[model samples]
Every structure is written in C-alpha cells, then in structure tokens.
Target: MSLLFCEVISAQQSLPKIHKDEVDFVNPLIGTAITGFAKGLDGGGTMPCVNVPFAMTNFVAQTGESKMGRMCYQYEDKAVIGLLATHQPTVWMGDYGYVSIMPQTGSLRVLPKERRLTYDHKDEIAKPYYYSVKLKADAKTSIKAEIAGANTCGMFRFTFPAAEKAHLIIQGINLNPELTDWANDYKSRLKRLKGYVHIDTVNNEITGYNPDRQSAQLGPELKNFKGYFIIKFDKQIRKYGTWDNKIIKKGSEEQFGTRMGAFISFKTLANTQIKVAVATSFISLDQARSNLKKEIPDWDFEKIVKDTRNNWQQQLKVAQVNGVTNEQKTIFYTALFHTLLFPRQFSEYGRYYSAFDDKIHNGESYNDYSLWDTFRALHPLLILTQPERINGMVKSLLQMYQEGGWMPMWPNPTYTNIMISTHADAVVADAYVKGFRGYSTKLAYDAMHKDAFEAPDGDMQKKWGDRDLWTSYEARGGLTYYHKLGFVPVDKVRESVSRTIEYGIDDYCVAQVAKSLGKTEDYNELMKWSANYKNVYNPATGFMAPKNVNGQWSAKPDSGFTEGTKWTYTFGAMQDIPGMISLMGGEKPFADKLKHNFNDGHYRADNEPGHHYIYLFNYCGMPWKAQELVRQHTGWQNFRNAPIGINGNDDCGQTSAWYIFSTMGFYPVTPASGLYSIGAPQFPYIALNLQNGNKLVIKAIDLSAQNKYVKEVRFDGQLIKNHIISHEQISHGGTLEFKMTSVPQKD
Candidate 1:
C-alpha cells in the first residue's frame, strides 16, 4: 500500500470477521490451566458449559480445588439428593450459598445430622449437558444429574447388596459448614443428618421466601417422590409448578448407598418425562413455551445439548484468531464462555418472574439481564451475533421500566433497586443507535430519563447521590486549583476519585443517548458534563490525578481511584479520547505517554478500566504500541494456575474477557457503544461465527514471541494501515491479517 493510501486506510473505518462454521477455533479452556486464587471452586476454573449463557443447570467440577481454594461439589456423593435451585454470584463474589441435596439408604429418616458422600475419580461422567456420579459403594448405587434452568433432574440407578439394614436418609438443608466438612472430614457427619425437601414448587418464589416453606410438608413416613405444597396469593394469579423427589432404597449402611430422582417440572407440562423451561414474565408462559417447544420441545436431550453447543459455537465465532496454542484457544473461548453466563435465562416455559414488579407476570421477556457486568461487553457481543436476544433484552428493559418505574441499574428478581451509576441510558442509546428494534424507542428513552432522574437504591444511593450536582461541581473547568482549591476533601471518603470517574461515564452515557434521540439541548448539556473528565487531568504526572477540596493535586497519590491509581485511571476517558489526547499535547507525545504508561507497571490488566487502553494507541496513530502491549501481556501472563496471577480482580471475567479478545487480536473498545477496535493478534489463526451469518477470521503473519509487533496489516487480503475494527464488519465476516516485526515498524 502507498503511504497516502495507508494514511487514508488508517483514517477510514476497518473491521474484522469470523466464519459461520469455525468450531475448531473455539477452545473454551484457555485460561483455566492456571486458575490462581480461583483454585478449587473459587477461582472459577471449570469446563465450559457448552450451552446458552447460564443454560446448563451446573458447571462441571474438576478433580481438585480451584485456585481460590475451595473444593467443587461432585454429583456422586455417598447418596443421591436433589439439585439446588439457587447459587451464589459467579466471579466477583464468593460462595454465599451452598444449598445441597442428598439421598441416603438403609432407613427412611430426615438424616438429623450431616453425612459424608464419597466418590472415586473414575465414577463420574460429564458432558456439556449431562453429568453423572457413582458414589462410594460396592455395587448398585449410581447418581446422574443434569440441568434444565428452574430445575435440576437427577436419575439414580441402584443395585442392592441385600443387607437387611438398608435405608434412605433425606438431608434437606445444606449449609456452608456442611459443604466444608463434606470436602474434608467426610466420615464425621455420616450418621445424624437432619433435613427434608420443601416438596412445594408453588410455594417457591425467587423474590420472597416463606419460613414455612423450609419445613417438610410430608410426615416422617415419606415414601418415594410423593410430596406437595400450596402457594399463597393476595390478588394476582401466577403460573405455578410442582417439585418431587423419588428414590428406591434398600439394605442400610451395611456398606450400601441409595439412588434418587429429583425433579422440578413446570405446570405447563403434564408429561412425567419433564422438560425444564424458564420465562421472563408471568403473562407469557405460553410464549416461553412456544420458544421452548419451537426451539427444543422434543425429549431428545442430546439434540438440545448439540443445539446449545451450536449456539455457543456461533456466538464464540464472532471473533476467532487462529494459529495459537491449545492453551490460548481455551482461554479465548472460556472468556467468551464467561461473557455468556449472565443475563441468564429466566423465561421458564414461556413465563418468568419479573424484575419490575414483585409478581409473576407473563410476557416475551428474557429475565436474567444482569446489566451490571453485561452492559460492558456481553450485550455488545450479543448485538454482533445474537441480535435476536438483544431485541428481547431491550424489550425486557422497557417492560421493566414500565412496570417497576425505571430501567434497572442493577436488577434482581423483583426490583430495579439501583446499584452503581444509571448507565442503562448508555445501553439503550447504543442499542437504539445500533438499530436494535425489539423495544419501543420512545418508551426506552422515557425509561432512560426516568432512571437518570432517580438515585440508585441501596449503598449506591448512599454513596453517590445527586448525579447532576456532582457533575456540575466537577465540570467547573479548573479542577486542580478548585482542589488546592478545597472542593473535594481527602479523609475517610475514599469515594472522591471514584465518584468523579463514575460521573464522567454517566455524563458520557447521557450525552450519547441524548444525541442518539436527537435531543440537541439535552445532548449539549450532557456533552459539557461528558468533558468533566478534564477536571482530573494532571499535566505534571500526565495522568488523571485526583485533587482535594482546595483545588491542589493530592499529595499522597497512592491508588487514587477505587481499585486503581491515577496513571491507570488517566487513560479511561473513552467518551472523549480526542480531548484526552489533546490534553496530552499531540499524537507523538500521547503515543509516547501511552507506551510509557503501559511499561510503568501501573496498568492493572485484571481490572476493567485499563482493559482496552492498549487499543487506545491505535487512536493516537501509534497502533504498533497497542500491538506490542497486547502480545507482551498475553505472553508474560501465566494463563493457568496462581491466585495473584490475575492482573486484578476478575470483576466477573471482564479482565479475562478482555484478554480472551485481545489475544484473538481485537476488542469491543467501547463496550456500551458496540465498537471493537483492532489490535495485534497473539495467535497465528482465529475465526468467529456471527449470528448474522458471517464470520470474523484473523491470521497472524510470521508470528512468534520475538515477532510480536505488527509489521504490516491487511483486511481480506487488501493491504491496510488502519488498526481499528468495527462491530458491523466483524459480524458480517472477513479475515484480518497482521505481519509481525522483530523491531518497531516505525517507518
């Protein structure tokens, strides 16, 4: 390419692509090999659940503890019990809940104490959708389990040793202590276990719990899976269901275990061979069922698993970078896998519990939209391939607003109880601008406005109240002087810098949404607010230095932002990078600054804010800088095993997700806006299958540890100089090639 053409190409739009059937490109276990603090169950290093995001009822447990030091649960405990309906937060939070169910043999009792369930390594079977475990038994007892959303169905097949002392002990309540004991002193709690099944599906609600629901409705002499309960209601009638446990036991602890069948079947289905379904609302059980029946109504479990795996294959296909090692493939696909975990599926059998109202409603909605982490990348990832789900998510957000009074900031089952900044406006605005038409634009706009007007609920509200005033105060133009200048004070209030950074994002989001909707006045107002990032700039340090109420830079500048420092926080002005660049003087110095920043050991790669900063070099006419950093980070890090090995907090896989994409050679640079800028590919070959029936393929040229920097670039075999890629081009399909260099390709 000529220099002029290269200049133009660099200035013009550029994007990448993945193929439709490039299944081999996806290896959902890249980063798991070195799961550090995530060791055991905590580090979250497990096999990919080849299904919809959170589609599988359970993730497979490896043989040992995760790097986080917790032993994962196994299906083949001493006895077969029920599969739990609740779980704790995935990445950021630890195991807050450890609900377990187990069945016993020898006697019909509640197992008044805890018991040890042991299993051999060879007795377990795990696939994408199926899992089974053979407990520690001589012969005859085997427990198999699989997930179908709202329910976990387990089938136990057992043979008896013909002992007169056979019995079945049902342990109902599972606690943290119990799980710890089960992982360690398994022999200690084998006798006096005390628990029973609630036996009531109708009595179960995601939002509310009845104390009585904990007690067994069945008397002590319970037999098989025969148990029942009633749902109490005030006015609104909702679709209900039933739960039952059935197990045939024999020959007590005279060296014997029992088998059990646990199921949670929806009311819409009369078939005993149950199909598990979930809905996002109460009014649309039929719609959910229609979805289920149309998509997967037949009892072919294998087909369903295949279909689910295909779904993941297609989604992960959005950005495939090839010619990498097996470990790279695993990390890449696994990161993609983690991204799909949440906004989980709540639309069971065409009906779902609503986040807007504390009631069971029905509508064609996707319930598990966790905007907290998803708004960053998952939703954008979906928009590129699974636009259909994006439509559903948009409509769900709108309905949530209509029924609950505002768009959810951090939604749970029945409340949009706000947590964090009201960034829904950014998501809606981006979706609308991106041409996602699943929901009403006007309604969405109104919801965004409503969400902006209110304070988020809980600790978020108490921490960051009055968004407008905060923005105004911060945007007054001379932040440093205003601080030497006595505006923000330093004390126990560690929230000062964080609040500023957050307000900047909010302002940018509001501006983007307003501009998209053609509200010029609102747009102008928010644009000024968006520029509030200027207040934190420190020319001396060339970072977004924090200041005190006196308008002077904080003297004690040690980790100013919540989890990052001034240098790390400085480059986070995504909303107005040009402004940030201008603040650094010009492109040359700006590029130099970025290069310097990257090598300073200040960039927290494990944290979210610093994730895409490597790509920022491309915007500054120094794309090679991004290439070097990308390759270096991928190469230097131990992709598997180690606790502090993570660059920062997992932040629900955001950092890992970033690594997954970067190693593949691109990223959704502006997550809320659905834009992926190109970078250097760490691998020699990669491909992604987009839901839009297109593929994104990336192949590195002369790639190696020494040849990390990009020597040249091409899109679809055409020579190119531009380093950035767009969302549209990636989803549509094409190959991106990067020629490597032993030294800087400065020419």
Candidate 2:
C-alpha cells in the first residue's frame, strides 16, 4: 500500500465520530442583527426563519420597521410585534402575501404599535425549525410564544398568564407599503389593495385572502395578485369578534377595503397554552384548508417541532464536518441552512397558481429564483449536493418559460425583472451539462435560444418593459447592443460594464450546453460572442471599462459598474480567467493587480461581483496567496456565531453559499466549468454524502488556524499536480487528503 493511503486510513480511524446533531449547530439568528448598513444592504439582514427546507411559508417574528422591511426580524429591536407568515426573499426586494399574528392580554389594541411587547434577547431561542420568545406586556402579564411548521402549514403555541382579556389578533397589511407606493408612482397605476376575512364561530376557524396590489417593484404582470390562508385554533373560543381599521366591531366576521383583519378573544387561566395551525395557498381558501388537513391535521406542537428538526437534520447530514472549533461548525451549518432557504416550493399538493400566466396549473412549481445572485454558487451547490432538487428547479424554470414566454430573472411567486441580466440561461445550461435530467433538454435549449436571439414584442414586450426602470440599454437590456456593438454601451445602459461581463459569462455557459447537445453552429456562434468582454477591456487603466457606441471609452470608467467599483468588475470575467489575465499582460501583472485590490480596499466581500476574486490566485499559479486571502476573508469579514456574522445581504443564500464552498476547501469559480479552485479547508475532516450513494471525504492533516496553507494534496492515493478539482471527481465519491503546514509551498 502507498504511504499516503496508510496515513489517510490511520487519520480516518483516529478521528471522532460526528454524533452531534447537525441541527444543533445551525443558529438561525446569526445574521438577524440590525447593523447601521442600508436596509437591504446590511449583510446581517436575515430572519430567524422557521420552516421546512424550501417550504413556501416561513414563520418569523417581526421586530423593526423600514421602507423595505422584508427581513422584519431584527435582533436589536426592543420588542416584537407579531409572528408573520412571510414570503420575503430579502430585505432589498421586499415581501408579498403575508399576514401577522400577535398575542395580547389586558386590552384589545388592534394597531401593531399598541400591541407590540418588549422582549429580552437572553429569553429567546432559535433553530432551523423552532423559535421561541418570551414577551412581557407589562409587570403583571407575560407570554411565552413558540413556533414551528411543515411545508405550508405553521403551528404557533402561545402560553399566556391568567388574564381577564386574552386575544390573538390576525391582521393582513402591506408588508412593503413604501415600496408599493414607490412602484405605483413609477408605473403610473394605483391598484386597490383588497382583503377579506370570514370567520366560522362553530368550527373556531378563520379563513381569508389578501390580494397584494402589484407595484412597479414586482413588474406589471403580478399586479393585483392574491394569496389565501386558513387559520384554526385548538382552544375553544369563550368570545369571538372582528376589527376593521382599528374600529372595534362585535361580530364573527368582517371584510374591509384596504386595512382589515379579524381577532378572537378568550379567557385563560395561568400557564394556559393555546396552539394555532395556519395553512396558506396561492390558489384558494379551500386549498389552504386542504393543505392544512394534509400537512398538519393534529395539534401536536412538540411532534411537529421534532419532525421539523429531524427533517433539517436529514438535509444537513448531506455534508458532515469534524475536527473544527464549535464556532466554525456553527458558521458552517448556519450557512448550509441559509443556502436551502430559497427558491421555495410554490406548489401546494398537486396544484399551483402562476402569477405569470394568471391561471391555475396542476403540478409542482417553485418560485423565488434569485438567478442573478444564485446562479453563481447557490444553484451550483445544489447541483453537487442535491441534484434531485436541481432537476425539479430546472423543470420549474422551463415550465415558467412555457407559460410566461421568457425565462425568469427573479420571481417572487411571479416574474419580477428586478436584477441586471438573464442569468437563468447560466443556471439551466449548467444543470444540463452537469447531467441533471429532470426536465426536457430540447425544450430548455429552445427556450434559452429564443431568449438569446429573439426580441420581445406584444405582451412579452410589456413584461420586459418594467425591466427598463433602471436602464433603457435595449428592449431586454443590452442584448441588441451586445449583438451589434460587441459590448453594451455605458452611455445607454445603467450598469453597462456589469451587464456586459455577466452576459459574456452567461453566453459561455450556453455555449457549453450547445456543444454538449451537438449543435455545432449554435455553439460556434455563442462562443464567438462570449469573447465580447474583451471589447470592454481598457488596456491603459487595467480595468474593464465601458465603451460608447462610437467606440470611445467612458471618461468616468467606474460609472458603469453595479454596486461596486471598476477594480471589482475587472476581475469578474470568471468564464475566461486566462483571457482576463492575458489582457493585463500575464500572470505577474494579474497577481499584482489582485493584491492591490485587496490592499487598496477595492475588493468588497459584501457583494456578489467580488465573491470569486480571492480564489483567482489559484488560476495565477499561486495557490498559497489564495489560501491566505480565504482565511483573511472568512475570519475577518464573515461570521462567528454573532449577529453581524454575515458581511452582506443573504441575497437568497448566495453570500452564505460562498461561505459554504470556501470553507469546504474549494469554490466553483465558473458555474458551468465543473471545476473547483482549491483554498484553505476550515475543518480537518469533511464527509459529503452524494445523492448517488457515494461519499466524498476530505481530510486535512495537521490543520489549525496557523497551519492554514496546503503543503500537498492527493486524491484517491494519487498526487494532484494542480490546485484545481472537478465536480465529477467529488461527485463520484472518494477520499481527498490535504497535508497542511504553516509555511507556504513556493513550488
């Protein structure tokens, strides 16, 4: 046997078994603290979301208020108003189709502010599936609230102190009122917000539907969309009533125009615990009731919480790490938890409603595709760990294309053309080349081809028109300019350089799929256009500057980058790193520029564009530098079980996905390349259980904080001569061993 094999076997046997429940390591409150950063821009703008993996409904406690308050659960808030059924992707985009539930005593205050109760952080507990908080209304009355849920149904258990008047108020309001108003102004349309609530006193149940008036923020297609929900309680109602616009009405049910809700008041003894089950649907109230019956029929709160925890545990067991500090495990598992929270399941049972088509369909559907952000890492991570889920995602995307005409960029249960480019092309093409066959490849290719070549007109044009709020670069944002001028013009587009570079990457991904599918002509055509990023390269400035239609460079070259500087976008050509390096006159210049980016504070780890910049050193033949930078970024900018752990918005789990890939000792620099750039591994041992019944085990010898650099790397008893590994090698399952040392390996 080889000496390396013997050493690996000995190490594997010596390591402790990972019997600690993975769910215990996940701290949902790690990123929920409110920092001074911009509302959506805050890196810690995450909620203690309690739900099943990718479940359509998330149960979270609301703390603070903001113009864009999607992440309403802030750690620093002195009090929590209510627990809400939220479909919020992030604070930047805002939430939709949500209702609030608050438990109050002593008096019946309908407004949120009057009913808000103070809470201490020490009295709160948060996990992937369960969350609990102690609410103190006054010196005399206190309430203990806990929440847990399945796919579409949530269970809320509240323990109240003995009181004369104990009430549970259920209200529906616009979560993002300011953003909706802003959208109304931009679209020049004021759609009335409609809400309805019907109460059944005999059954002790309340059912309603709230139609969120579409705003320019969500595009025109989603205007006046509605979502229905059914709420049932276990405790008997001593008295039942309703309220409209804070006006007290002694009745069983009431429906109001814009601001309306229903409440139930009952007398309870001390330590009386009441449980409520809430089920929601995009289809109708009856479907909501059916979902509730199918998902959570009984009031077994403890069983539901246990089952939810076990579900998260099973999902998290896909990758098991050992020999790391407790802090590192917390960060690792928390990131893994965040990565699974988005692109949620939109279908309920066997039925779904598509806001894109304004019709009901009979099948499973997925929504919240933050493709512009997730195509980089989140989707690729799923392709490696959860290929079956990726298959479902691809099938869902293709179905949306069939119904809506164009593939989605971002969809909050509907197509919301919010971000920069059509990167769904990259996601579909990546999944296809990676051999995920849940959908029709021919249909996917046809859809991508049409999106790439054709222009929008008629209804399609109207849908694409809302995307022109920021830039009028083209009807579909720079497709015309990219075809005609080889690059998008800064004078015409809002974020010209960012769109051009991203489109080039997307084209490269499409070309890969075309080549694999035997479309020689299409492959050659897309490959030529993939080099269009070269046209925007500014030789003298050492940056990817934007150019006008006249081929003149923008005098203010940095003006075209999105949410970042010129230096940030300069290193964004992940599809062609060698080409990018050669444009800057070779390896030494490229390495120097990268170092300067970090030294001069040009590299922003808080955003999407600069995520892969640290790993670029491996392509420059200096993996040691990449190792140093990874440690620096992970230690300094990332989390350590604190509220401000994440340095940027979760962005539908893209930021956390970066942390997961980096800590696992590699990252997918190019989404479609099937290649991972090796970096420093945070854990000494990692076992990733692939869906194909294979296990990829990664072990680091003598790994510690100081010994972060890799001295030697071997795969399956053979030495890896380079600093790159392929997805096929990892997915097929084998042992990858890394020898660690404090000193750098100059050779």
Candidate 3:
C-alpha cells in the first residue's frame, strides 16, 4: 500500500512519462543542503518547503540542530526528527511558532533525540506543494508520511504497520529535548518551553500555542507574539498521554511547559492510514480552526496535493523558457520557486496579528522581509514577475510604519533590526516607479522619509553594530553624522563604509519617491545627500575606507566594511556610478578595480553585497566583461542542478533572483531607477509574461558555449546603447534581441 509520489514535481533523475509542466522542472532539493556561511559549497540556506506561494506557513522535515548548525533540514542528514509546520523564512533566521509531528509504531518517546527515525534521500520527494518520505521507525517497523498544504493548513497522511498500534507524537515547543537539566530543574525547564498544548480525547483533536521567537535574542521582544495551532484527526483516538522532563503521564490531556508535548494512539488494521489536518495562525486558536475548516474540511489527502500543484503550475506559467537544457530549466524553475517563498503572507484569512503593535488588526499584512538582501534583486524582480504582490507588499510596509512607527529594516515578522539600512524605501519606490500605486504613495513617502531623515532614539550614545539588540530602532544609524559630516565616522557606528554606501542608495530611492510626489525641495535635498558616499572614498588609497571621528581615514584598506572586504563597498555607490567612475580616475581604472576583485578573489557570489558587481561592468564602456561574467556565473560554474546549487543564503530568494535576472540578460543595478543593466542571455529564447498583460520576449541568436559574448543588442529593432533598458520600454512588451558571437564586438 505504497503512496504514489506525483511525477510533476519529482526529481529530475528519471521521467516516467513526457511531463510538459513547468513545475516538473522544479527540484526543491537543490538548495536544501545549504550552510550558514558564504565560503561553503552549500550556503544558500534554502529548505525544500511544501507550501503555496508566499504562504503564511510551510512544512519541512526537521533535523533537530543535530546536523547543520542552525537549519531545520539539510539534504545530507541521515535522520529527521519529524515533519514540522514552520514559519522559518530562511536558514539563518529563527523559526517561530513551529510544531512537529512524527508517527511511531512502538513505545512513545517524547524527546526528539530518542524518537528520531532514519531515512534515505532516495525515499524522499520535496516540491513546492508536497513532500513525502518513508522513515524506518525501527529496524523491524517502518512508516510512510505524505504532506500537502494550502496557504496555512497542512495535511499529513501516515500509513502504519498493523501489529504495533499507531501513535502520533506532537512536539509543541522549540526546546532541546536532550537538555541535561530537565531532571534537576523542572521549573527552569518550564520557563523555557514558552509553549502550551492540549488534547481532547472525545473530539479527537489537539490545540496549542507557541510564542517563542528565537530571533528576539538580538532584537526587541514582543510579549504578544504567539503561534496558534489546531489539529484534527480523521481516526479516533483510543488512548492519549503527555510528557515533560522524562516523565510520561499516560492519560494526561494537557501540558504547559517547555520540552513538553502530547501523544495519541489509535487502533488500526494492516496498512491502515490516518490523516492529521493541522492549521496555524498568528491570531488565535479560533482562527487556526477557521483556516483548517476553510482549507481542509475533508479527510482526502490527495485533494490538497492536487489543488496545490495546480496552483503552482498556474503560478509558474508566468515565465517560460525554451531552447534550454533540462538541467538549466530545473535550475531556473527551482530558483523561480525560491523567489516566491518569502515576504510571506502575515495576514490570516482577513485578520493579522502584528508583532510591531502587539495587537490584532484587520488588514493585509506581509513580513519576514530580508530587506537588506531582497531590496537589491528579490524585490526588484517581484516588481516585474510578481506584480500582483507589489501593492500588498507596499501596503504591508506602510502598515508596519503606522503600527511600529517606522518601516522595519529586517522584519522578522517584527522589527529585528538584524541588517543595515532602510532598504524598504527601495522596495516601495521601485514598485511605485514601476507604475504600481495601489498603496498610498503619500504614506510610502512618509515611511521612506522617516527612514531617511529620522535618527533613532540614541544615534550618538553608542556604536550601533549589526547585533546591538533593540536600542530603540536603529533606523539609519549614524544618520546624524551623515548629515553633519557627509560620511559616517567609524567611531560613531560599525560598518561605516557599507553604511555610507547603502544609505546613499536608500537616499537615491527616497529621492525618487520624492520626485514622483513633486516634493522638489526634499528631492533636491536627497539627491545631494545621495552623493554622500563620495565622502568615504580615500582617493589616495583607492578604497572606501572608514573615517574616524577626527576625519582621519583608517590605515587598513579593508577596515569598516560589512560582511566583506573594503573592495566590496568600494564601487557600491550605485546611485552615482558615473561620479564613482570619475572618482576612480576613469572608466579604465574603475573597470580595473572591479576586475581586481574578480581576479584577486574579493568578489563574492555567495553573498548579496557583491552580487551586483558583475553587472556594474555594464555601467562602464566594456559590457563585454559583464557579458562573459554573466555566462560564467549563471551557468554550471555557480548555479548547478545539484544539492549545492546556490553558493549563498538565498536571503529569501535574493540569490535566486540574481540568477533569474542575470540569465534573462538584465538586472536592476539601481533599485529606484527604472533601468535594467543588460548582460548576456543564457537561453537562446526567453519570454516573460509581464504583469501588464504583455509578453517581453528576449532572443539570443547564435547563443552557445562557443558564442558566450553579446556582439550587439537591440530593442524593437532599434540598436541599444550603453547596455541598459528602461521599464517603460520593456514593460509594454516587445522583442529585445541580442546578437551573440565567440569574440567580443568592439561596438
């Protein structure tokens, strides 16, 4: 009685039939083995999630931190704790309001370390909509679990072996079950669980709430933040129990402690199946039940899988690529699938629980914005490919502004202040500049203005480093210094070099919003401030070195950079690249400095800061260098059809978005700017089903391994110059063709 795994989203190893669906090309396993750092082969911190696009929740298999440092699941893990209902946006981020379930055939073990089951990679299937695995519960017994889901509800169907009696263990907390103090310090243990669970035998149901947000360690703690879950079983519960601190209560119905959970057993026949429908909500238990009733009112498991797959198919059909290899197609769709996973829907049904205000609000909401990383490419890509989400995303930002008093730099569903800058300004301005005004432009401008101008409560009291933790809200740290001195002093804030560069970019974005709103005074002011990055440039040293409070440059060239060397932020002043070129002496010196990073191994594809550096070559006269680098990065060299596909944190799809744009022969080097810096197209022919009901077709004639450089480019039969295209020109939908040749064309 083996369940059939759907071939439409199956691995690319073998095709049982001719599958023409674009979802068929997606292989979620490609990025599951990601590591936490950029130097590793698998640093893209992506999970093989099963959920609808931009879902409120996704289902994944948990590795219990016994494997990868902080990831829930890695492709190479020999065993998994259980299937988890999680809101973890990426590998580096903490998973909040999560729970796990595992089916067993023997005596119940409450601890994840005790009940872990071994499984082979061959026995697993992961897709955007569904995931299934066969686990060896013991050497003598085995169980199969199939998971499918809607936006917030997930259904797990388990097939059990007949003789041993079926049992389901529910993990309601995020504590390390193997902690040594559970025996000696029960009270301390209870305080740590931060979760509660209840069992109702008569109704065959379980309900609980977990309010723990692990990321709050480095940010403001929200007292009202909680994740509620409602679970219903199709099969009757013959027996039930709860566990805490190694003590098992065979009939207890509820528990309110850490490392605590409940288990239920059912009488079953050989090869009998049991279905558990679980619903989650940040609002309340009632809302969780409501979501469950709306999404999974029936016991049929395959119905959920079918509906979700159809949803993904329709979602992916927005972009189609022809004349590419199956491997390339798999990588492309997998990257596409990754891009749609984040800026998750924070609203449940019609209501949302705001961590910012600590209140329930009736409005649209979206969060888990990795703004520092995403504002570069992910948000820009969504501005085009996922136009439907643009307004809602902007509205969500405005909502955060109204509730939290400002837009979050990194909203871990709330303001974590994890990353730097106010790049939400870029997200808002990019959407508006793309002609999407569904949200209030005035409100967006205010938020951007607040981000740009308003200093945090204590802007000068202390250096606000990356992990300084909830010191009011470090919106534009050292902003006061920037206003007075043009460049932030390293003594005033950490990572001053990058801060100046990023703040300058955000200034450009805010200025764009201001210009659109006819705020000429603010626009002129911001446009001037946008060039503030020039102050950090040490012309004698040829690096954007940090400046001390005394206005002396750092002796070390690589000092004061964020997550990279000084070379990383040297050319990061994208708002004024032409000025940056002149500052670097000329295009040749600027190009040479850019080339030095690539040649000397300072350019990082594993991180977001330099992801745009290759495209910057297009800004100079020698786009030929950019074209070849595009092929090298987008092809088998970096993005591959393997577990280590992406070499960096997908950063909620920023890494993947880079692939999509680079392979499509364009990129948004500057966010608020409507232009896409041109690069070489990977595919011979590509088509984007734009949001404006038109198709933008790109053709790369004579494209092959031998012909990797673009000889010339054209738009609507007009020869393109300076290697750029505007949104107004491309969004209306016309052919942008490229003539490819083995040798670089001087023109």
Give the alpha-carbon lDDT of every model.
0.48, 0.79, 0.83
lDDT string for model 2 (1-747, tens) is 322223333554554466678888899988887672434446567789899999998998887533344367877789988888888767766566777789999889877777899999999999888999999967967899899978888999999999888999988654333444443332332244667787887787888887753323455545436778888889876576777665777765766545568888988799999998998888888889899888887988888899999999989989898765556677889989999888999988888888678788998788988887899889988886777788788888888888877788777666665767778898998887777777898999987887666654431223233334422212247577778889888776668888788888888888898889899999898888888889999998888998887899988877777778888799998999999999999999999999999999777788899899999999887899998887777764555578877887778889888888887788989977878888877677899898779998988888765677899898898888778888888889899898999998878
- Please, what are the lDDT tens digits per residue for candidate 1 over residues 26-45? 43333333334333312333
Q: Give lDDT for model 1.
A: 0.48
For candidate 2, the per-residue lDDT at 363 reads: 85
Least accurate stretch of 10 residues (summed lDDT) in model 1?
A: 210-219
Candidate 3 backbone collisions, by pair: 35-42, 44-648, 193-258
Which regions of candidate 2 deviate over 4 angstroms? 1-19, 36-41, 65-70, 175-190, 213-216, 457-476
lDDT of 3: 0.83
Residues 1-747, candidate 3: write the lDDT tens digits.
101112112323543347578898899888776543344444667888788899999988886642113578887788878888998887656778888898887777768878888998889888878888889977876788889989999999898877555689998875653432211122333464468889987778999998766565555667778899988888887689888758788889889876678899776676788888989999999899889888888887888999999999988888888765576779999999999888999998789998889999998899999998999899988877888888999999999999999999888778876678998899898888889989888898989999888888889886887765456888898999988899888877888889988999999999998987889999999999999988998888898899997899866667678888887788888778899999999988999999999989888887888888998887778788898788777766567677877776788899999999998999999888998899989887889999759999999997766687898899999998778899999889999999999998656
Provide the clash count, candidate 2: 2
Write the candidate numbers in order of decreasing lDDT. 3, 2, 1
True-vs-predicted CA distance for residue 322, candidate 2, Å? 1.1
Candidate 1: clashing residue pairs, number: 117
Error (Å) of candidate 3 at residue 220 is: 2.5
